[model samples]
Target: MERESDVDALIAEGAAAPVDGWAFDWLAGRAAEERPPWGYARRVATRMAAARAALDVDTGGGEVLAELPQSPPLLVATEGWPPNVTVAARTLRPVGGRVVAVTPGAPLPFRDAAFDLVVSRHPVRTDWAETARVLRPGGTFLSQQIGPGTVRELSEAILGPLPPPADRHPERAVADAEAAGLRVVDLREATLRTVFHDVAAVVWFLRKVVWTVPGFTVERHRPALVRLHDRIRAEGPFVAHARRFLVEAIRPAD
Candidate 1:
């Protein structure tokens, strides 16, 4: 009875918390994930320092972009989610960055060769052709992408046993980039540890990272949540692995 009450309270806390912007500060002590060794944010800052013009694709709430110590002369970020567009604009205002609302999987709304540097962190999908089109000759496109089967353990904990990951492989991305006429200069991969102290953390994460469960809801997955909560109580904290990859491609000089 006491365990049930605890579960109920935790679920309510997680469900009621706002899942706005891409920041994960809400999960402070509830969950933790190891950072990738490639240091994507630091790399972006270094590149941004040298860029004349830059574009950030799928800039969720512009949180990552807001961290850069320096900004390009012309800095632009694109977001697909409407809620995030407003958040991103306000967050990037101090940096003189403009936020453009774009449709997911649609062509980037930019003139050819519009940006000298293009970056994206965990974009839902990469339109390689569109990315290439917007990049100037000798420009670079850098991204830290979510690899196939990222956080599969957490996903399966909520959902059921799943099949092998079918896509999001670094090789596939490299092939797509080459096909789009971008030269692949660097590629790196990492599988980092992720831990959740309670079921509430899982609920909030699934809600924010929607791709984890196609259609996640506290009510719909309550049974699984309960089971997971019990399992965590019996075992230690739940553990999962998050896969990430960094790719750097460039357009050849004209």
Candidate 2:
């Protein structure tokens, strides 16, 4: 059994840790999440091996991209968050990839038909038209996206009952892909089990994933966090389900 002081220390440690870059090393073993069965990283490595030029959108810290066993000759990545851009540049340097600081919802800084393959993992937003424009004939776009209402169990723990998501369904994504003149070759969705072993884990996650509560701060949500902490102390770990989806599209060979 953890003492109250110990728990408070953990929470403070989590709150002070840098949330920049997508790396979650801080949460190692503190929380666990089931991975989607599709093995997105291995799939990306396979595709990268066959491409001549590739771009990665919203490449947070280049953590996933840097792990690729192989990379295309011309590798480029974009990051919207400034802190992550620096981290990504450093992480991707050894892999010979360039990182661009991009503005959210703004145009991608690349030429039309510039890449043969484009990939992103959990992009903040998918610019379907820009994705189509950047791909050469017969190029492919592969992404693992956070589906609607991901981690609602955690979000609602902090904020009270919320409205249901109106969009981000795979069907909507397919329609948008088709509308952008890309063919949706494959798409899949999954709900994975997630467990926060401690309140500190929950606090760290909410801070890193800002969308969870929009404006989650230790001070603002301390009351809710305390409530959750008490619940954990009594009920073991807090359980939640994380939603994710995989979408693959290809530009027509014509």
Per-residue lDDT tens digits of candidate 1, residues 1-254? 99989999989888989888899999999999999999999999999999999999999999989999999999999999999999999999999999999888889999999999999999999999999999999999999999999999988988999999999999999999999999999999999999999988998999999999989999999999999999999997999999999999999996
TM-score of 1: 0.99
Please give each candidate's TM-score. 0.99, 0.97
Clashing pairs in 1: none
lDDT of the structure predicted as candidate 1: 0.95
Error of 1 at 22 (Å): 0.6
Best by TM-score: 1
Writing each residue's lDDT as its tens digit, candidate 2 over 1-254 gives 46668668878977887888898888888899999999999999999999999999999999988998888999999999999999999999999999999899999888899999999999988999999999999999999999999989888889988899876788999999999999999999999999998888888899889888897889999889888888898999999999999999999989
